[model samples]
Target: MDKFFKLKENNTNMRTEIIAGITTFLTMAYIIAVNPDILSIAGMPKGALVTATCLTAGLTTIFMGLYANLPFGLASGMGLNAFFTFGVVIGLGVSWQTALTAVFIEGIIFIILSLTNVREAVVNTIPLNLKYAVTVGIGLFISFIGFVNSGVVIKNESTMVSMGNFTSPTVIIAAFGLFTMVVFYKRNIKGALLWGIAVSTIAAWIYAIIDPQGAAYYKIFLPEGVFKYESISSIAFKLDFSIFNDPSKIWTLVVVVFTFLFVDFFDTVGTLVGVASKANMIDKEGKVPGAGKALLVDAIGTTVGALLGVSTVTTYVESSAGVAEGGRTGLTSLVTGGLFLLAMFFAPLFVAIPGSATAPALIMVGFFMMENITKIDFSDFSEGIPAFLTIILMPLTYSIGDGLTIGVLSYVIIGLLVGVYDKGKKKVSNVMICLAFIFIIKLIVSGIG
Candidate 1:
């Protein structure tokens, strides 16, 4: 009996590493569903485009985890999607192809920044308080996503997206998912996200069967193939030579490229630090292992996504959900990546899981993000104001960049206002100053528009 027990314990220990990997991957798998829906509205075949989008995210996330050794996951970034879909494609009247072109260029710039370690320098320059604000702001932003996904908040012409109907499918499923997750959390059940996803996924599937024609439903996995990826046949992945062929106003491309790069820059850093905290992936120095490599892979992933005719690829903050599940190692990430790759075979199944089912996960993740609020220094108006702007603007405004801008500029301005300009955390660096100034100018331009 003793020998048998020893053998069983050894087997369990051996598999623990694998379990860790799977937990990591599962942490970010929600993106496999959400990214596609957000991206594939260009009148393309919804099924095919969603599959491709998932494939890209999965591959990028796996690469980040398995090869890069980062605990982050990749997906169609939220704000960048807004940039691609609304701002660039719709507002600027540019083609999605052009937007992809911009994503490609921006990725290349990121690689350059990573190589020169310019990104590291940029990260190091920020004061600790601002960093805390950004992290907390991101947390709030994440919670906002959760609330919206859960269908808790909704749009109103006058108030703009207040609480939604309690009986809504999104709300009900989200509520159920959140409940299940909370139960697991309270019980200290490991792999809570997996359980939450499983329960929600099953609920989603049952809903589909019952409704048959309803707008909300569930998904069941299956295998299919012959994936249709157009806009991928050509374009050998480089600067569009065609734009060069007609050297007229090619400089506009430069602006587009920079905008994409800027978004990726802040987004990746923010996600890394934020998710790391939730996952407990941070080290004594508050750094994660292979973060730099993860950033490099993520940049490469964005470049690849653009080439494959997708939007800006980025590290998802959603991985925090997995962290809540006790996903501790790269093994967890690899498992998630494998699942993503496997999801390609069963495309329709993923689509079937409604927003309501996953909505709870978002809320739960956001619940976790609020944990950082207590860390902010409330005594100093300089610290308090910037932190406050970050936390408030992130969710209310629904834009990470906007929150960051408000926070940074507020820090600079409020410091000046409070006569702490000299003593308060070194005056905003030149780059931050420039970014803030440009953002102000752009706000003016947007207002004029």
Candidate 2:
């Protein structure tokens, strides 16, 4: 195992990797329920989506471990899934089957890019400061997600968002969990985040038992099931390619594919770099080893996921929890993949782990990701302004692509204005400038549409 994973070189043992895998799985397992619930809005059968999510996550995560030899987990992404249901199927009035076809085509594009070194070129061209910003930005994004999920923050009529009722039991338990995680992390405990989640979950379960109505109010409690076996026949291999036959729909298909490509491209890049930075896996050149393979597997996962009736499958940001837990090799990914495969039979049990429990781990991981801020050359306004924008816009816009796109544009424009290039070495790269213009055009087109 050491020889295979180079565990010693990575400074991790089998036991550490296994524990890290479990920790990562626990942090992200909510996707089993969440993906189905969201995608069902597009008229998909929830049961089939559950099965598809598990299969795609399991198979592709294992492939990532074995092929890329990286400890990242793959699943249906949160943002892309919402776009699939709400933006495409409902807003565009396209059929769910047609949406899947578009996703499949996007995956094919991704595969071509990965194999031809196009993806690698984009990764290598990103400036170092922006790279760090991506890490910190994703961290803040994760924390914001945790806060919203745990009801620590909520929408308000007066302000766009405001503090939630802290007295609520759900909020209270999540706060306690965050406190526990912080304390344990300070003490340098190995599985502090995991322990915090367990304790918080137990508290929630006890509260639910004591006050079933209150628990019902929050829609959180011990789910009553040991097993959940959902049939996949409804969506398995049910992709409809007939949308290509309609010439009138070609323009809509083009726009749909472009949207999928744009979001998936940046999301995968940001996530791979962010999670890798957490593990200190990127080299001095700011490149990840086996990036092409990792990206290929991700593309394959998306294609298969769409075929199996789910949205774009990509690397989850939650993998940072495993890195924080001392995972340094592919074994960690293997363990996570195995659990996802097993989750096919235990869906109900996995879904029972409430948001309040996982929120703490995400909060702590966000704390860890903030460490990258120190690496940014804050003295240089050219770098600092864009970095600052990246950090805020990620959570503020609730979109990684938006954060990255705007950050790139801001960096390039500011670099030009200051007459100082990245690292004072050269002018902003043409690729980034072109991408920024494309993003602006995309925004305009979206508004018009």
Candidate 1, residues 1-449, lDDT tens digits: the string is 21322324323222443444454444455555556555555433445556667678778877876676544667778768766777776776656666677788888888887877767655555455666676677777877776776668878999887788888665777777788888987997765655776687677666656675563332233212334333334322433435555566477666677678777787777677667655555555545556677778888898888876677888877667655555555544566677777766655555455556666766677777777677778997878888888778877787666777787778767666555646654455676666567768766755875
Stretches of candidate 1 off by over 4 Å are 1-40, 43-48, 90-95, 215-240, 280-290, 416-449
Per-model TM values vs. the true structure: 0.83, 0.96
Expressed as tens digits, the lDDT of each residue in 382-427 for candidate 2 is 8899989988998999988889888888887887766653456647
By summed lDDT, the worst window of 10 consecutive residues in model 1 runs over: 1-10
lDDT of 1: 0.65
Q: All candidates: CA RMSD in angstroms?
A: 5.3, 1.8
| lDDT of candidates 1 onward, in order | 0.65, 0.88
Best candidate, lDDT: 2
Clashes of 2: 0
Give the TM-score (vs. native) of candidate 2.
0.96
